[model samples]
Target: MRLRYLLLTLGIVVLGLLSRKTSICSIDFVRMYVGDVLWAMMVYFGCRLLFVSLKKSASFGVALSFSYLIEVSQLYHAPWIDSIRATTLGGLVLGFGFLWSDIACYTVGVTLGFWVDSLPGWGRK
Candidate 1:
């Protein structure tokens, strides 16, 4: 079960990275939004991996909070944090700016996570 969540998280990370490539996705809207969606999905799966005993709702709550927090954190632009955001990994994880659409994407992603987590064989412990 833990392995499943870990693999799902990693797979989502790959997809999120691929979403940024114009050649791979082709669609402008998809390229713009899919990364944020997959980012939230990865967060949910990561939460599930770390808190294996948590109920689906609890896991969703944690993931949603974390995703939103990260998004909100973009509003703060201190030199130290900006320098971190200048790095490749930091740019990917922290992002450059805040978008209202990203919040919607996150909601969809976390809700999708909840739906997936409720599936019988897919989510069963």
Candidate 2:
């Protein structure tokens, strides 16, 4: 179960870096955060699916919170990491910088996570 979460987190972090780098989309802060949030939600769902024993809502909550933590980590300056984020495809996956709106995104993502998981015959044990 823990491994599932870790893998999902790793995948998301990679994707965030990619998005941050190759984003042809306008860096409209809101849009960026929303995309970030949605991706986080997907990661949450993926994580839950990877490990089936965890409850639906609980997995969503955990994923959302962990996603928030990663967003927060962007505030720190990691030169090598920033370079990597700027260069590699993983950079597009990993996020950069801070945005308060990301919290809203996290909330929406979690909600979406719940909704998706609740789909009949989808994520159930």
- Highest TM-score against the true fold, candidate: 1
For candidate 1, the per-residue lDDT at 25 reads 82
lDDT of 1 by residue, 10-94 (tens): 9999999999998888999889888888899999999999997888889999999998999999999999999999999999999
Clashes of each: 0, 13
Q: How do the residues 4-82 of candidate 2 rate in per-residue lDDT, one tens digit apiece? A: 4456556656555555553554566634665666577666867675657878767776887777887777787778878
- Of candidate 1, the 10-residue stretch with the lowest lDDT total is 116-125
Candidate models: Cα lDDT each? 0.90, 0.67
C-alpha lDDT of residue 100 in model 2: 80
Candidate 2 is scored at a TM of: 0.67
Q: List the residue pairs that clash in candidate 1.
A: none
Residue 124 lDDT, candidate 1, scale 0-100: 47
Model 2, C-alpha of 58: deviation from truth (Å): 2.4
